[model samples]
Target: MEEVDVVIVGAGIVGLSVAEKLSHSFDNILLVEKEDSFGRHISSRNSEVIHSGIYYPKNTLKAKLCVKGNELLYNFLEKNNLPYKKCGKLIIAIQKNELPILDELYQNGISNGVKNLEIISSKKAKEIEPLFKSCGALFVPSTGIMDTHKVMKKLEFLSEQNGVLISYNTEISAIQKQDDEYILSFKSDDFQVKTKILINCAGLWSDKISEMVGINSEKNDYKLLFCKGEYYKTTKYKDIKHLVYPVPDPKGIFLGIHTRINLNGELSFGPNAYYVDKIDYQMDDSYHQEFYESVKNFLEIDFDDISQDDCGIRAKLQKEGEKFRDFVISNEKNKGFPNFINLIGIESPGLTCCLSIAEYVEKIIE
Candidate 1:
């Protein structure tokens, strides 16, 4: 058996961020991941766009963390000599009726303390992005993109340098609280560990981890819905600068399928969201028409110009047609579990909010 002061389950960005930040104050800290390498799932997948804290409601964790995280992440990336671009973003309203949504987003963004969010006219938008089709656009200069893989690598390096032990290919089969410490059992290798503090940042399987520790998901409304979003890469559009997005559905459904530009100056559009029962990453060509139709209104592309590229699953707290739910990050002392912190339903902006989320958990513990 191994003994440690703190054990952080899941090596996703959120977990790794927490590990790196806490390593400064805590000793004998351990980070365990089921995968052989770090960030194989929710962390690596989806658009690598650095958000501007525009979409979330004011004073919510999503807005605050993302707004603060946006700055922290940029500084971290630059300070670490990582690759990134402040390419800016545009949320366009193709329909006249959607103009109000832009206003609402602008107001919400201003209230959330997002910097330099201006609703630009279609003429101004065309000056910035000539290929875009828009009636009006919310110009968010703070939004950008980064090398997510490199960012995670640096965090892992910093944590290890700070004396945090990260174990790969180790899964927590079961967890039980004995006295004040947590006893974690592994699936194989006859491995078990004990830690005084347990931090659950297990992105997709976080709810199951909580249940193992006797916190009911339904009772706490902490259940996660697996929303699968698929992307399509374009061979035609590479020079288009800035991230282009549609006005988000206010019903609090999914963000519409939008554009993604990687560091190589390649362009892709996608992540049409839908609910799924199981964890699956297999891309389906059956969505070719849907993908084309979704983007045709914003981008000029023939159906053949786009091809299925990749997909990722979002562990959302909101089910299909459910209203918005803020990220459920809490230290569950009131739930009779002290020294236990749970982070669930961290979806969009999780990447941008990774470091701030860690700082948030650090505040909870300190």
Candidate 2:
């Protein structure tokens, strides 16, 4: 068995971020990925939005990390010459009744220390976005979009440059915790490694990974719920300047089907939330009308202009009707699994929180 000081599973944004930061200090770092390349799952899919730390409960990991990560990510992007847009965002309220929710979101953002969040009147919103029709809007100046692929590639490059050994097409089928190290067995390849630290950054299979090491995720209230969100690309809007979002679902289920502008000046709407049994990228056309209605509620878009784009699954901890759930980043020493770090239910703001999350994990290991 090859022995290492640290083993990081999964090559998603968060995992890559962790490896890149830790590689600066730690030697013999091994990053293992199941896919042939990095970021095949959640990292590659979705809006690639740099969330502005809004909507999450105050003092939660999601809130703190996202707000902090927003700053760190922008700095990292600039330093590395990675492409991104500080294109801003607007959470709009269409009906008069929804204005309260808009206020609540602004307040929540303020409580979470999000800067430059404002409640703009209809005329002010129109001045910013003429096509946007709303009673009121929460203008979030910090929200932006970046090329996730570019970000991941840069992170991978930096990590590799620092002597981080990345093993692709290798999946950890099982894991066992010895006295002070973890023994990881590969699925197809007959190989195992003993590492002093095991960081479970596995995006979708995090709960399963926890269970493999005798950690009952459910008992610890870190159970995984696979919620799939589908997006639809728009043909009508191309040069839209900012991300246009509807008021969040009243049930507090999701951020609602909103308009996301990519870094390449492309527009897509969606990520309407629903549960899925298995991981599949196949887009269902049945929800196109639903997408149309949702977009029409906030933006002036015809149904025919939108087409089925793609989908991404979120590793959620909260089930349907559950108002809120925070990201679970824990060093399981108290659970008898010292040096084993588990990150669970890292969904929406996860991409935004990648760098800050890495710093959080670094402090834990220290």
Can you give the TM-score per candidate against the true fold?
A: 0.98, 0.98
Over the stretch 235-300, how does candidate 1's per-residue lDDT look in tens digits? 897867888899986667677888899999999987888889999899769999998898899988
Error of 1 at 196 (Å): 1.3
Model 1 C-alpha RMSD vs. true structure (Å) is 0.9
- Model 1 compared with the native: what TM-score? 0.98
| Model 2 Cα shift for residue 224 (angstroms) | 0.9
Q: How far is candidate 2 from the true structure (C-alpha RMSD, Å)?
A: 1.0
For 1-366, candidate 2 gives per-residue lDDT tens digits of: 999999999999999999999998899999999999999999988899999988899999999999999999999999998888898988888899998998888889999999998899999999898888899899999998999999999999999999999999999999988898899999998889999899999999999899998998768887888899999998787889988898888776688898878777888888898888988888769899999888887778888989999889999998888889888899999999888999999898999999999999999983
Would you list the clashing residue pairs of candidate 1? none
Which residues of candidate 1, in runs, are more than 4 Å off? Answer: none
